[model samples]
Target: MTRRLLASYLSLVLLALLALELPLGYVYARGELNRFTGAVDRDAVMLAELAEEIIDAHSTDMLPGLAADYAHRSGGRVVIVDRKGAVLADSGASAARGRNLSQEPDIASALRDRSATGTRRDAGTGAEEYYATMPAWSGTSVHGALRLSHPLGPVQRRVHEVWLALAIGGACVLAAAALTALALTRWITRPVHALERAAAQLADGRLAPAPVIDDGPPELRRLAATFTRTATRLHHLLQTQRSFASEASHQLKTPLTALRLRLENFEPYLDPRAHDSLDEAIGEVERLDRMIHGLLALARLENSATTPEPVDLDAVVADRAATWAPFAAEQQVHIAVAGQPAGPAVAVPGAVEQIIDNLLANALRAAPPGTSITLARRRTEHAAELHVIDQGHGMSATERERAFDRFWRAPGTHSDGSGLGLPIVRRLARAGGGDVTLQEAPGGGIDAVVRLQPAAPAEDRFHAGRPRAVARFAAHPARAPRTAGATAGARVPGGSDVRT
Candidate 1:
């Protein structure tokens, strides 16, 4: 940008210089030429007066000496021509005596009793010469003509010197303009660069002691001040929201626990008919407790802001699958793992585990007995994907769209789910620079997918010692071969299966 500005400035300066100096130079050259020619014309007229006296005396003896003296003094050529257009005397060897001068324009004009001045090329030397001619008269009767000739080289040399000076002056002016343009550009761009950096930091959640800029133009300074104010307000608002969520969860959990304990103690003393009602009340309290916990998790995930780091996704999956193995076996369902040797992926410290755990819980709650749930990992050039596939009833398009909304559950599904699981999973995944999505699984159920940033090649080698397991189930007995395929029942809410 600076270079472009400098070039534009120099170009304008050069154009202005050309517009002003070109005409002035032409006028100067013309004036100098006319001044030199006028002086030579006056000298020729005076010499004509002397030549006329000698011609009237009918003697040519003194004419040659006078002409030679004038030529030697003025560094020019002189010639005397008679009225009949024949050369009478010559001052230089180049001007021959008795030569017919009738065809020369200046001499012809002089013979007709008129003075003439002109510039023309010399035939012998091929050099430009200026000529001045006047008639020699004896009482109005023309006797002869006197002519003076001078070379034009000196006049042209003076004009060239003037133009050279103008060119040098123009170059100096353009150089100064370039320097000024560079300084101005730096002054304008410095504050812009500062603002860019400040914006980046603000986007990354660094809001305390907002960026300060006291340099540059007044408009930029005002903009910076406004940005600082906005950041402060945003920080204050976010802190208030987080505090409310944290306080609400803590305050509600205490009372809910006390209520559950009281109901459990009363169960022993109550009659059998009243015991059923008491158990229902206790179950409601437990569901409320789970909802509060989900809210707390959502709030924490939303508040976290940290840079992503490399994590062994395969190890995370294996660990989480192992943790859920006992529950799966109790329900008579098998959990299997299948994937390639995928490298580490970038995610928040523990974000990947939380995501996998939520997906497994959801799948387990939705899967029927004797059906298998598969956890698969796939790697691509730019990202890695983790999928949990279960064989159960899948959702329609509308349900998938609202699946990430807080406290939203599918119609006629289980009431045990707080509906915050998917939302929390989404929040955690996004905070770790990744995303979670739900789609229809092959054959019958839903596929929960999580995409994460791929780690660099250098980071991939750090997880080399970890074991890679494929198509394995933890603590499960081998099943007997079936004579024919058996299909599981359609998924229903609040049935024998757990809620995700």
Candidate 2:
């Protein structure tokens, strides 16, 4: 953009220089030609008067000397022609003592009692010359024509010198214009580029203070000021929102705990029918509590601006699998861990664990008895992925699209889930500079996939010797190995393949 701005500015300057200089150069050359020609014409007329005086006095012998002296002083040739179409004297050489003068255009016009001036090339020297002729009259009877001829080479040389000077001046102007354009472009684009970077950081959830740029054009400076204010306001608003969510969750938790305790206290004094109703009430409270926690988690993840660091994916996966194993057993479902984690992956601290926990909770709610859930980690060239595969009634395309929406539940699914799990998982994943996707699992279920940034190679890290634990958990007895063919047709919405 800066280059384009500079180029455009310089182009206009060059055009302006050409427009002004070109016409000025032509006029200067024309003026020089006219001035030289005018001087020659005046000299020719004066010589004609001298020749007339000589002819009237019948002293033709002095005419040659007079013409020769004038020719030497003026740097021109002079010819004295009589009325009878013949040269009487020539300043150049004796060979022109009687050369015909009436046939020449300038001399013909001069014989008609009119002065004439013109320019023509000399055949002998191949150089251009300017001629001026005037008739010498003795009482209206033409005595002879005095013609003056000057070579055009000197005038052309002067014009060339003027044009060269103009060219040099124009070049200097263009150089200054180029420098001015570059400086102006830098001045304008510096703040604009800074604003662009700030905007990008904001979009990436970095709500820090924007850089202050107090220089450049007034409009740009004002724009930068406005941007700084806007970023500050936005950051404040987001921080306030996160604070509200956290405070509200904390505030609600006490009352909810008291309500649950009160309901439990009444359980011992109630009949079976009332006890069943009281249990339903307690379940609703628990659901609300879970929802509050989910909101707090989402807020925390959204507000966090922590940079991602390298984490051992194998350790996280194994730990999460072990934690979820007992819960899977309670649902009469088996948990299977498969696939080796490839090196350390990059993620926000504890982000992978939170993602795994949410996915496992959701899968447990959907999985039926005797179904096996698979926890797998896969690595690609640029990314590492954790996938939770379960055999359950999978969601449709529309449900998959809104799966990450808060409180959104798929149709025909049980109400045990708070629906904030997937949303929180997605928020955490994105906060870690990663993403979460839901796909149809093999054998009619859902695959919750989390993509994280791949860690830099060991040699590229500052502390290359730090050891990473590669946790390998034992597969459960009820776990069944998956076949590749069974997962062939599974695909994430928007055409992303989790298997890859």
Candidate 3:
């Protein structure tokens, strides 16, 4: 932007210089030529008067001296001729004293009682000369012609110098204008740059990213102030949400746990018929607990600003697949990890695992006995993808579109399911500059895909190949596998493109 602005400014300066200077130089040169010719003509007239007086006296003794003195003062060649064009005295060349100059064009015109003044090329020397011829007349009787010639070399040099000076002046002006334009462009674009940085930080879940830039134009200053205010409000809202989630964690969990434990303690005192009802109640409590956990996780994801870091995609896929393999075997189902190995992907901390865990758990719920669930990792030019493909009857297009809405469950979903899974998955992916989408598998199932922002070829990792991570399944019998990600084609309304 600065370069473009500077170029535009300099271009206008050059055009103005050309428009003004070309005509100015031309007029000055023409005026200088006119003045030179006028001065030469005046000198010619004066010498003609001197020649008239000298010729009228019929004594040519002082004619040569007078012409010589005039020529020495003016740096010109002077000559005196009679009415017949006979050279009476020559100031420059004594050899031309007796020469007849009647045939010369300027001398002929002067002998005819006329004045001639203009430029001509010298026959003897290869140079341009300016000649002024004046006739010597006394009351209608012409005695001779007084002619003066000056070399055009010095005047031409002066004109050339004028042009060179104009060129130098224009260049200096352009340079000054460039410097001024650069400074102005920086001033104009400063707020824009600040806004761009703030937007990036906000996208990364940061609060107020930077201080407002208030030194630009009025419009930009206003925009910066508005943006700062908006960011501040957004930050406050996120902080408030974080506080609520944190407080609700203690308040909501303890009561639900105590209530469930008390309900279970009554199981031993009840009859077998009432025991079934009690079991249902306990199951409801567990489902509520899972829902609360999902809600709190989502709150945390939304409220915290987490920078993306590199994680080995292949290692993550392998570890999670191995962990779920035993669980799939228990249900007489298989977990298959396939597809080409990809480079590391960038995501927020624990985002990949949480997304995969939710998707895999959902896939397991829909998988039939003896069927296989595939975790396929693929790589595009700029991003990696992990597709949790399950062999189940997926939702329709309408349901898929609405799947990303908070707590939006499809028709006929199990009572144990929490609908916040897909929303959490999407937030996690987007935090790392990636996205999630539901695609229909080739075999009538849902291919739940989370696109990954590819990390650098050689990156300093956040948690590269760390085993038994926090989200890893240990003592799995006490905890039911979560359905955090929408494995069965819960998609955003818009379609996606293959970004390379």
- The candidate that wins on TM-score is 3
Ranking by lDDT: 3, 2, 1
User: How large is the C-alpha RMSD of every model relative to the true structure?
Assistant: 8.5, 8.5, 6.7
Alpha-carbon TM-score of each model against the true structure: 0.64, 0.64, 0.75
Candidate 1 lowest-lDDT run of ten: 473-482
CA lDDT scores, all candidates in order: 0.75, 0.75, 0.78
Residue pairs that clash (backbone atoms under 3 angstroms), model 2: none
- Model 1 over residues 1-500: C-alpha lDDT tens digits? 55665677678878887888888888888999889988898888889998999999988678888888989898778889899878888777635888898888888889899989888887778889998898999777998899888888887889899888877887787778778767876676677767777777777767646767787788988988998888888888888987887688778978998999999999879998998688668767766776776766666656656677788888877877786676676667798989894668887766676666567667766778899899998998877899899998988878887888877888987445667778877776787678988899889799988898888868763445433332111111111111122222212211111133
Which residue segments of model 1 deviate by more than 4 Å?
1-175, 178-194, 212-215, 274-276, 459-500
Once fitted onto the true fold, the runs of candidate 3 whose alpha carbons sit more than 4 angstroms away are 1-34, 52-63, 79-90, 96-114, 120-129, 137-144, 151-235, 274-276, 458-464, 467-500
For candidate 2, what is the total of clashing residue pairs?
Answer: 0
- What is candidate 3's lDDT per residue for 241-278, written digit by digit as tens? 87887788788889999999999899889998998688
Per-residue lDDT of 349 in model 2: 64
Higher-lDDT candidate among 1 and 2? 2
Question: Considering only N, C-alpha and C atoms within 3 Å, which residue pairs clash in candidate 1?
Answer: none
lDDT of model number 1: 0.75
